[model samples]
Structure formats: C-alpha cells, structure tokens
Target: MSDNVTFDAIVLKELNKPLELVKGIQFPDLKKGQVLVKIYYAGLCHSQVMEARGHRGQDPYLPHMLGHEGTGEVVAVGEGVTKVAPGDHVIMTWIKGSGHEAGGCCYAGPSGETINSGGVTTFGEYAVASENRLVKKPEGIPFDLGVLLGCALPTGAGIVLNDIKPEKGATLAVVGLGGIGISALLAATTFDPERLIAVDIEQSKLDLAKEFGATHTFHAAHDDWEAEILALTDGKGVDHAVEATGLAEMIERAFNVIRPGGGELVFASHPKAGDVIRLDPFELIKGKQIRGSWGGSSKPDRDFEILADLFRQGRLPLRQLLSDTYTLETINEALEDLENRKIIRALIKISEPPADAA
Candidate 1:
C-alpha cells in the first residue's frame, strides 16, 4: 500500500437523504501509536441509519462518516505501533483510551457522534485507530465475526449475564427481535432460562428468533400483545424483560410484563430528547427495577477474548446472524434492505483500494 493512496467512501452530506459515493479523500497518515487499517468489512448498523435520518438528537457534525463495526488487516503503522503487524487481522472497537489502557468512551475524530465527541471515527475504506482499540482476530475467525464483538455481541450478552442475570430456570422476555434481540435470546440460553419469550412486530423475524434459541414468540404489534406476553409467562409475568427496541412504548411494556419482583433491562438508546414512558411507581416499590447498560459494561480486552472463544467453538452463532453483503457504492441499497427487514445484518465490503503512491 502506498502512503499517497486515496479510496472511495460512502459519505452523508446531509441528514435525511441517500448516501453518495465520494472520491479523492486521502486516507489519514498514521500517527504515533496509531495504525492504518485496510478495511475489508464494515457492518451496517441502526445507528448509521439513525444518524442519516436525523433521528440522532445530538448535533452530529455535518459531512459525517457513518460506521462503527469494522474489521480489517493493518497495512501500515506509525512510530512505536506494536500490538499488530502489517498482516494481522484486526477488529475495530469503539473503546478508546490512551496508551495501552482502555479508557472511558472517547473517540478520535469528526465522526464520533454515535459514541462520543470527535467526529468520523469510522465509515471509510481505511481507518486510523489506536493500537489499543484493536483486538487481533484468531486465526480462523473471519473479519465479519470479529467486528461484532466491538458492540452488538457484548451488548446482547451483557444484557443477559450482567443486567438481567436471569437466574437458573427463570423465564425471560426479549422485546424487539432485531440484531440485538436475537443475540439476547442466545445469551439467555446460557443461563438455561426456563422460557425465553421473543416479541417482534414481524413474524418472520420472530420465526428467525425462535431458530436462534427463543423458546416462545409473540407479535408485539398486535393489540393483545401484553395479554399474550402475560399468558406465555403463565400469568405470573416474566422474571426478566429486556427492552432492545429503544421505543418508550416498548420500554413501558417491558416493565408491564415483568413479575412483581422481576427486573427489566433497557439496552437500546433512544434518539429524541425527553421521550417519555409511563410506568407505575408502585412497581419500583415492589422491587421491579429497570437498568441502563453501555457496551454491556464490557472491558473489550477481556470480554472480546471470551466472545472470540465462543465464536471459535461454534457456541455463539456469528455467521447465522448476517443476511447480506454489499459494496460501499451500494450503501443506500444495503440500508433499504435493513429498513425493510430484508436482512438481519448487512455488511459492506471494500475492494481493491488503490495502492499508496510515492
């Protein structure tokens, strides 16, 4: 790869419009402790869709780059870069800290609005990430699987083992069976939850959720959804409910479906400010609690390795969750597929970047 190379990137010039191919943006030169990654796979995430639609209430810097889950091989390194070599496969995570220690959530550039300040962390053919922010992929883990540990897997697993921590033989309900909902279902199985109830508007997604480990499924968009969830739990309500849809009505219902002393975990981040959900205060008095989680409260250095081992053993279904792939030039099409629920996950493949020139 040459130092003077440039690559085509899908860029959002304005909120609420289709993306366009933009060329001639120079890949950032590596700085100290930074490595230049030749991105091979970038996961299309809901956050990117939210940002493009202006659903992100926070003021996102305009002309923003859009992507967070990315994986590739290091093609170049700056002075003192040591964690990865030129050919080592790597996954880029949102966790950023100085030196080798993971720090509180901080991003390095103009596109960091999805996670923090400093915009433009990802969404390019090549990205400059700190050496510490990357975890080397095991010999056989493909780039697509590796990218997930950075966010989705940990968030879903954390909701089960950390937030809900469903006790043995407990009954659990997962609302919004999207990417994260499906993952929560699998994680809940590790605890041997007596009944894993999955709820989603689309029956196809619910059917897919059942294949992934959901013990029961319900149509949330139906008028009698609350009654159906209660009936599934045998009228006692579930011991745990996870709200992954990030909608206030869904969040409220998660509370309603939990047993008197059960717990609720809210994993999705809402876009609008002050979106309100009504819930009875008496439930709090009775020990029903709703908690918020970030990145599954994960330390990537440790949690990522654990997830990798699971992926290696096939205990965690990585590839099964993916539905489609596209080139950056077809990002709009990819997003449309996602919006229509045509795919569970869509990944963008960047191919044949120009060689760096002197």
Candidate 2:
C-alpha cells in the first residue's frame, strides 16, 4: 500500500451524534516513528461512547477517528521503527510502550477536508499509529480475543495484579460489571479471595459475573445491596472495592463499602465533566484511600504477554466477556448496544484477515 491508498473509517463529525462512515479516505505518508497497520478487529469501549456523547469536554477535534483497543497487522513501518516489522501481528493500544512515539496523523477526508486522528485509531480498515502504541500480538492467539489486551485486559486485570494487589483470601467487590469490571472480577479470582462480590444494576451482568468467578452477586438497584455486601464481609466491608462505572454516585458508593482501616478504592472510570465524587473526609482519616487508575498503571510491553499466557492456560475467561460482534458498517449499532448496556463487550470487525494469517 502507498501513502495515497484509500480506506474506510468511522469519523466523529459532530459531538453527541452518530459516527459518519466515510469511505475513500486517503492514508497519510508515514512519518518518523509511525507504522501503517491493517486493522482487523476493534473493541467498543465506554471511553469512545463518552467522547462521542461529549461527556468529557468540548470537541476540539471534530471529525476525529475514535477507538483505542484493536488487533491489526503491521503493513509498513516508518523510519527509526524497530519494535515491530511488516507482517507482524500487533495489538493497537492508546497506552505508550517501547518504541518511538510519533504525533497524530492527518488523512484526506471524503469531502476534501482533513480528518484528524490520534496516534492510535482502530475504528477503520487501516490506521497509521505511533510505533510505541503497537505491541506484537502473541503467537497463536485469536485476533478477536487479542483485541482486549489493548485496553480492557490491561486496565482491568492490571488493576488487580498491579494496583490493588489484594492479598490471598481477602474480600473484594467490583462495582459495575462492564468489560473492565468483569476483567477485574476475573483477575480477582486468581487471588483466591475469600469472597468476590459483583455489584451491578443489571441482572444479566450479575449472572455473567458469576460465571467469571464472582463468589457473590448483588443487584445495585436493590435497597439492601450494600447491606448484602456488608453482611458477606461480616459488617466490616471489603478490603478493596473497584469502581469501574464512570458514574459519580457509584464512585462514592464504592468508597463507602471499603473497610474502615487500611481499605482502598480504585476507580478506572472516566466520569463526565463537572461530575464530582463527594466523599466524607472522615473516611480518609480512618485509612480509607481512593485513587483513580490510569489504565491500571500498566506496562503493556510486560503485562500483555502475561495476560496472553493466562488466556492460553484457560485461566482467563475472555471469550465469555465477548457479548457481540459487528461490522464497521454497523459501528453505530454496536455503540448503541454498549450505551444501552445490552452487551458486555462488542467487537467491531474492521477488515478480513489475510488468507495466510489467522
């Protein structure tokens, strides 16, 4: 493929509006530290939904590409690129890794205007990504399943293994059983927690959480849901409470369910702008700590391999997290399913895999 090669992409032409499936977009010439990748599968995450709804802030980059988690094959590498070569299957992620970090790309739009894209954008048939944003996919892993390693797995599982580090036999609760929440719940099971409580408003999510090793499941809509968790923990509370729902009220509630002494709450959600989480200062005085997680503070170069190994061993129930799959043409429908909480995780098939490749 050449710099003038035309491809298709889903663009955010307007805020709080449906994405525009624009075709015949020209790929920009690869700059230093950039790699051209043929995107195969992309994961639909809440972050994209938030951005599309203008929940986080103003839209400085209208007509920008959206998506940070995906699986692709390196079609070309630019100058100074060494971490990966052409034909190397890779995981496209927003997080930085080992390689040269290049700036965003500019593509020729269908209407002769320029389309803005970040270092890593996967809701398209092809992407020009920073070298540091791509990690070589593990051998023999299904490309569709490998897409989670780009974001959900690293953030969710990384929180359990790297951030919270719950001790064996400890009690833990995961609020909001979304993709990230369930990933955390799955990771917690490896620690042999005495009780793993899954909390969610939807019963379907709660049922799925049980299949992911949740020892106890509670519907957050119930008036006594917190009480149920408290009772499970002998009225003290869990040692660690993970808040993955980007809602302010859920964040506060997650903080309230932590044990009085030396308890910790780690939130991975990106709440809407001006949505403040009000917590009692008194809780901090009692050694209750609350902190936001940035992709589970993960080092993808090291953690993605570990997660892949877990998946190979059949220890990580990743397939169960995949609720649905859609084509790039139906990207809006996929996003709607996600926003409506009708799926755990939706995979967008951007392009077909090569005949020789898996």
Candidate 3:
C-alpha cells in the first residue's frame, strides 16, 4: 500500500474552544478494512456542537478529530475491503453499513503528536473511514446534498419510515425545525398524514417547513403551543410526535401532546450527559409509547438507495433544506450559525469536488 500523503484538518485540542486548523497532518498507513477518501462536503450537526462544548461528558479522547457526515470519493482501500472501490462516490457516515467496521485512525499532528479520530471524521481535506461507514452515492445526486443523506436524512426520514411507520392519514407533529426535524417533515408528507404540523421557535424554520409540505406550522415559543397542537387534532392530540431538539423541556412537551392510547413519540435528539426526562406513569399506562431513536434505526446500505431515489424524483426537496455553506477556513462561523439557530443546516466545503463529480 502506498503511503506519504498529508492533508489539512480541524482538530479539537480542548473543550469549548475553537478547533485548531492544522495543516500537513500525516496519514497513517491504511489499516485493515479502511478506505481513504478525498472529502468534498460535510454536514455540521448539533451533536458535534455538544461534543465541542464538553456537554457529552468526559473527554478521554481530547485533541481528537470531529465530524461524522460527508460526501467523498474513494482514493484507496485497505486490505479485506470489498464494498467500495477507487473513484467511487460515497457518503461518509457514522452509521455502520455493509462492509467491515474497522477501528479508528491515528493521524500525526504537526507537533508530532497523535490525533485520535473515530471510525469516521469528515471535517478535513481527506479522511480515513471504516468500510462499513460508507455507502455508494447514487448517480445524479449532488455531492453537497449527498452529505445530508449521511446523517440527517437517514435519522429524520428513517424515524417516520422505519421506526414509527405511521399509518396513512395519521396526525403527526415534528418539533424542532433543524435539519433532522425538517427531514422528518419531508418524510411525513409522503405518508399522506392527515395533518403534518410543524413546531419551531423560529418563523423562518416554520416557513421553510411549510414550503416543504407541512400542513400547519406553529411557533413553539407561544405559551399555548401545546394546546394549539392538541386543538389541531380536535383536542385529542396527534397520533405521532417527533422531537428532534435535545432540550429536555421539548422532549417532555412532545410526549405530553401525544394522544393517550396508541400515540407514538420518537425523540431523535442526543441529549446532554446529565439531562433526564420525566414522564407521568399514567401516560405510559395509557399506551402512550415513547422511545429514543438511534439514527432512526437506519440500515444505510438499503435506506440510502430509497432516499436517493426520492431526491432524484423531486419528492425529498433535499436542496431546500440547506441553509448555508462555508469553507474550512470559516468552519467556526458555520458552527456559530448552527448554535445560534441561524441556519437550518450547515454545509462545510472541505475541498472542491472532482470536476466530474456532478
């Protein structure tokens, strides 16, 4: 296997600080079941913000690399790799897919120290990902939009399609209008939900949700927001409620507004380490089901194809969900926009896609 390639990357040297933009990071030799990729675009999710802020608890792996969703082209493959090949366009994701789940990679930092990374990290010009963490990018999909398929699309869309599987004409509400929540709204539209109500604090997000096919939109900041949702369902409450915000209050509110019997709640957010949610036992006893979603229990190998087909047919509206794009030099700005709720979804252009990628 050839070696001696170096690239620029963003490293989290400490908690609650701007990531260190280090150049000339040396790539270690390919380990078994690894694939080297030339990254094109990556998506910034709220989970990375929590990790950067030290909200996810102890940081045993300080000075590590970050980011989990990206679109790239395979540059090389390690031993025992069979799922993808050189020059193949792929989505790099944290969700393990069809191939081998290789261990994390170690990149040599400029100061001669080892920078630890997970099985997949994408905020860089190049990345080494486990074979199972990649799925082939379908023809005719833009690489930029393909980044969303890596995480938000699967997690949000999957929650409705795979986990909840709400019946046609069912009433549904999606709280939080970020990428994941908006993706859920898009997916819910396809189910022919009788009422797809969107809840968010931002009018901009609600407007965007309506454009993406929400039957109604409500501002969550309203004191009677929950009541309004219940009113929409004729005082019974929605048959399904999906909460994508990691906030405990929102999670509780989502659970409280579901119909008593056979109502389903799926919280897709990754809550902070010390955060706990409280639900009344009476509600549980009444068959008000509640559960957390792990990437919407997605099977990337199969689901990616379905989502890509939807995008191609213009049903998914993947492009409308993107709010802004920034290059690696302005990644901190991207993170701030995400934290401030200024953007629906932030895309980081780590490197230009190959000329023929389109």
Candidate 4:
C-alpha cells in the first residue's frame, strides 16, 4: 500500500495546558485492525476537556492526542478489516462496533518522537483508528452531523431508546444540557412523555432544549432545581432521569430527583477520580434504580441506522444541536467554549467535505 500521508494534528503535551497544533505529522503504515481516516469534521465533547484540564485524573499519556468522535472517509484499511473500504463515508467513534478492536496507534511527531493515540482521535486532519471505532455513515446524513452518531446519539439516545425504554406518557427529566443530554431529550420526546424536563446551568441551552420539545426547563445555577423538579412532579418525581455532566453532585442529584418504586436514573458522566457520591441506602431499598451506561449499551450497527432514520424523517433537529463550528487550529478555543458552557456541541472542521458528498 502507498505510505506517504503527513498531516496536522493537535497534541496535548501537558496536562491542564493548551494543546499544540503540530504540523506535518507523519503517518506510519497501517497495522492490523487499523483504518486510516481522512477526517472531515469532528465533534467536541466534555471528555476531551476533562483530559486537558486533568479532571479525569492522572494522565500517563500526557503527549497523546485528543478527541473521540469525528466524520471522515476511509483512506485505507489494515489487514483483517472488513467493515469499510476506501472512499467509504464513516463516523469515527470511541464506541466499539463490529470490527477488529485494535489497540492504539503511534504517530511520528514533528520532532520524530512517538506520539501516543487511543483507538480514535479526531483533533487532526487525519486519524488512524481501530476498525471497530467507525461505522459506515448512513445515506441522507450530512458529513458534519455524523459526529453525533459517533458519541452523543449512542450515549444519550441510547440511554432512553435502548436502556430505559420509557413508555408513552412516562415522566422524564434530563440534567446537564450538553450534546448527550439533548440527544436523550430529543429521543425522550418521541415517547410522548408527560414531562420532559431539561436542566442546565445555562439559560441558552435550556432555551434550545425547550425548542427541541422539552416540556419544562430548569436552570441549574440556582439551589432550587431539585425542589422545582419535585414540584413539577407533584412531590412524586419523574419516572426517569438521565444525567450527562459526569459531575458527582449532579449524578447524585439526578438520583435524588427520581421517584421511588421504580424511578430510574441512568447517568453517563465520568467524574474526576477519587470523587465519591454519597447516596442514601433507603433509596435503593425503596426500589429506585440507577445504572451507569457504557455508550448507552449501544450496538452501533443497529442504533445508528435507527437514529439516522429519525434525522431523515426530520425528527432529530441536528442543525440546532450543532451549536457552532471551529477549525482544527482553533480546537483548543472550541474546547474552552464547551467547558465554559458557551456552546452545546462544537464542531471542528478538519477538511472540507467531499464535493460529491453533497
């Protein structure tokens, strides 16, 4: 196979520091179960922020790459790969799909040092990810919006559609209106929930959630969100709650906000290490349920098709969900905007979409 591809990528050289946009990073030969992707667009999520700010604990891979969800085209595939072929439009995700699950790939840094990368990283113009890290982009899905399927949809919507399976007229609330929370909120609406409440510290996010079919919106900056949510449920509580912030307190809050006797809370947050959540033993005894999700327990091959159909039917308002866009060079700024709650989901434009893709 041809082996001459050098590209630019952002590198996290130190924890709690800005990432460097190193140029002309050379690529090595693809290994077994690896797929070389010419990235077009990538989505920014809080997990990247946690890594950059040292929120997710000590980083052994300090000089590693960042980002997990992106949309691109397959440039080449390693041996034993059967999932996708060259020129196939695909969504790169951290969630594993049906393919060979390779370990990490090593890239030649600008200074000739080996830079570590996980199964997938999209903060670059091109990415070398495992075969299982991608799914064929379904027809009718735009290149940019594919980022949602990579992480947000599978995690957020997966919690409701795959895990919770809330019945029609079921009362539900989603706290922390990031990409994942909004995706869950959008999916929850299809169930015809009695109360689809959206909670976030930002009024802008809450406002957008309202437009996306949230029956009620709550501002989390105040101290009364739990009380207000309880009042909305008439002191009973919601049938289900999905928390996405990954904060320990918020996870605990979502747990407390649900009603007893089968109230369910599925949180997708990965809070800082050493952070402990204190919960009352009585809640568990009262039949309240809580479960942590691993990518919403999704099997990408099946779930992405369903979500893409939702978007095709004009049910998933992805245009509104894609809050803003930034270039690869400004990826740090994009991540900062997400951390500050300035945007819901930030899109990183790595390269222009193929003209024929339109």
TM-score of 1: 0.87
Provide the global lDDT of candidate 4 against the true structure.
0.90
Each prediction's TM-score versus the true structure: 0.87, 0.98, 0.98, 0.97
Q: After best superposition, candidate 4 residue 67: deviation in angstroms?
A: 1.2
| Residue-level lDDT for 240 in candidate 2 | 98
Candidate 2 clash pair list: none
Task: For candidate 3, write residues 225-306 as lDDT tens digits.
Answer: 7898888888899999999988998999999889998998998987889999988999999989999999988999999989
Candidate 4 per-residue C-alpha lDDT over 89-176 given as tens digits, one digit per residue, 9 for 90 to 100: 9989999889999989898987799899999999998889999999999998889999989999889999999999999999999998
Q: How do the candidates rank by TM-score, highest first?
A: 3, 2, 4, 1
Error (Å) of candidate 2 at residue 283 is 0.8
Indicate the residue-level lDDT of 315 in model 1.
72
TM-score of 4: 0.97
Worst 10 residues of 3 by lDDT: 1-10
* lDDT, each prediction: 0.71, 0.90, 0.90, 0.90
Better of 1 and 2 by TM-score: 2
User: Which segments of model 2 are wrong by more than 4 Å?
Assistant: 355-358
Cα distance off (Å), candidate 3, residue 199: 0.4
TM-score of 2: 0.98
